[model samples]
Each structure stands twice: as C-alpha cells, then as structure tokens.
Target: MNWVLLIIAGIFEVAFAACLGKAKETTGNEMISWYVGFLICLAISMYLLVKVTQELPIGTAYAVWTGIGAVGTVLVGIFVFKEPASFWRLFFLLTLITSIIGLKFVSN
Candidate 1:
C-alpha cells in the first residue's frame, strides 16, 4: 500500500516536472494551463511523499522518490523535448533505476 503510494507520488513528480518544462516553453494563456498542472501534480506528489515518509525511512523514501522522478523526467525530456540521448546518459539512467530497485528491495 505504502509502496504503491510512493510509486504514485513518483509518477506525479514526473508529471509536475514535465509540466514545468512545458510551462517554460509557453507564454501567457498557454503557460497558465501548464503552470496549473504543475501545481496540482506538485501538491499531490508532496502529499503522497509525506504520507509514505511517515512509515518509510526518510533517506530511503526520498532517494526512491527522486530516483523515479529523475528517470521519468529524463525520458520525457528525451522523447518530448528531444534532449540529448547519448550512450552514457542512457547507461547512467539505467544505473539509477537499478539503484532505486535495490532500495525498494532492501526496505521493509
């Protein structure tokens, strides 16, 4: 249950981050929607993060949450924004994913 919450929070983190990126690209009325989306996702993500942290270790929970967010945001940046997709970047991304999984396995 908590794990599910954490995962959901992480997904929200991704959404908020993507919204931020899109907001930066927009202007006036176009930006408003992205900003609103960013705020909504940010709030939900934080709420879920706080809820999960009540039971999970803070360091572990934070790392995993940010890990998921980082991976998701990078993928979005790559696919949507067409950011750099060098071999090294992909390698490190995979490593981050592995570390996140390891943290989950080691936790209660």
Candidate 2:
C-alpha cells in the first residue's frame, strides 16, 4: 500500500540522516562508507517519497516524512552522539509528531 511505502520511506530518511551525522564524526577516510550508505539510503527514500506523493497529497507526505526524520535524527543524536536530550527539545519533538499525525488524519 502507498501508506506503507510512505512510512518505510520515512524510516529510511531517518536512517540516511543519521548516517550522514555519523560520517561527519568519523575521523578517518573510513567515513566514506557512511557517505556511500547515506547516498544509497537517500536514493531509496526519495524514490519511495515520490511514489507516495503520486498517490497522496504533497503536504501530507512531506509532513510525515519530515516529522519522522526530525524525530529519528534527534533520537540518534541523543543516543549515538551522547548529545543532551533536554526537556524543551523533547517537548517540541512531541509537538511535531502530534502535528504530523493530525495532518495525516485530516488529509485522509
């Protein structure tokens, strides 16, 4: 289903973004692997996004994709990078998730 594709794309979007962050953190040329991984994931994510957009509303698809990416990136930044997960940041993340869900529901 298109909805399943949309969700999968969102997950891949988050994965590629997290890989990009990791690539930046790598000190040596080994980071190239992350770059490659990022690109591959990015391509797949975009493909799925375009497919979903063909059948769904742009606003809805984009919001869900971006929201999932944002939340997933913040979570990776906190857990993988040992970044602080402040209360305010989590609050806004929750807000973003809520808005994304609301948009999806309304659009459908």
Tens digits of per-residue lDDT, candidate 1, 6-104, equal 999999999999999999999999899999999999999999999999999999999999999999999999999999999999999999999999999
TM-score of 2: 0.94
Candidate 1 residue 44 C-alpha distance from true site, Å:
0.2
lDDT digits (tens) for residues 25-80 of candidate 2: 89567799999999999999999999999999998898899888888889988999
Q: How much is 100 displaced in model 2, in angstroms?
A: 1.1
Provide the overall lDDT of each model, using Cα atoms, as 2-decimal numbers. 0.98, 0.90
Over all chains combined, what TM-score does candidate 1 have? 0.97
Q: Name the weakest run of 10 consecutive residues (lDDT summed) in model 1.
A: 21-30
Top model number, TM-score: 1
lDDT, residue 107, candidate 1: 90
Candidate 1 deviant stretches above 4 angstroms: none
Q: Spell out the clash pairs found in candidate 1.
A: none
RMSD of each: 0.6, 1.1
